[model samples]
Target: MISHCVFIRFRPEISRARRDALFAEIDALRHTLIGIVAVYTGVNVSPEIGMDKGFAEGFIVDFDNAGSRDAYLMDPGHQKTGARLVAAAVGGGNGILVYDLDTGHCLVRQAR
Candidate 1:
């Protein structure tokens, strides 16, 4: 299995209420998309101490393999969720980082 992770930073103008709504929408994708083995999302709790950049939200999705990850990229529900994320939560430029996990070595490396 491969863990597909994405960290998202919301726009400065976006309100906390809007961000919560976006989080809800993202959580729904787990039920909508078929290829996802598991999905998890959360807000950054320790922005002041841990990260200087104030990244807002993040997602961790487990897939059976690389092919499932590719399929998820093209899935309509996933695409719709992304559009909603951009329109409702992140109004300005968004920050994202993706990674792939190797369960055997317990290591995560940036996905190409």
Candidate 2:
């Protein structure tokens, strides 16, 4: 199995309504994309010190393998939905992070 984890930090100027809409749009992907075994997303509310709470929204998606992950990345629904969500949610370049689970290493990559 492969896990695609994403951390999204909202633009401080974004309204609550927009944030909620972004969350809803993200949730809608579960039904629109094939090869997604499971999808979970939510706001980060941890109180841990020095923790980058800048990342307010995040999601974890489980797939059968890397091929499924790649498909999800290129899926038309994902592209359309993601553009809408990011255009509304992100503030700048530092607002997102992505990680991929491998055999023993969690490879971090740019969230493009």
Candidate 3:
């Protein structure tokens, strides 16, 4: 299993409505892509100090395997979406942080 995590710090000028719309667009990809187990998106709401840096929004994409995650990364739909995300971010591509975790175990717990 693979967990694709992304943190985004959008430009200060971007309105809340626009940010919500972008998240909606990202959520829509679950239907178009293959091997996507789940999609989660939201804005950071933590009150803790200095934890988030400048990233205000984030998303997690669960995939069945590394191949599936890699395919999603190369898909044209993802490319388009990513381009839009980068355009709205603070420093173009530099404003986003991405991490992929290889879950050695199944993402879901098995029944006893």
| Least well predicted 10-residue stretch by lDDT in candidate 3 | 101-110
- Residue-wise lDDT of candidate 3 within 17-73, one digit each (tens)? 988888788788889888899988998889986699988798999999999899999
TM-scores, each model vs. reference: 0.68, 0.75, 0.87
The ten-residue window of minimal lDDT in model 2 covers 85-94
Give candidate 3's TM-score.
0.87
Query: What digit string (tens of lDDT, one per residue) describes model 2 on residues 16-103?
Result: 7877776677667778777778888787768885586567677888887888889889988777767765665566445678888753
State candidate 2's TM-score. Answer: 0.75
Provide C-alpha RMSD values for all models, in order. Answer: 5.4, 6.5, 3.4
Return the lDDT, model 1, position 75.
Answer: 82
| Model 2 alpha-carbon miss at residue 68, Å | 1.1
- lDDT (C-alpha) at residue 103 in model 2: 30
Q: Output the lDDT of residue 73, model 3.
A: 91
The candidate that wins on lDDT is 3
The pairs that clash in candidate 3 are: none
- Answer with 1 or 3, whichever has the higher TM-score: 3
Candidate that would win on TM-score: 3
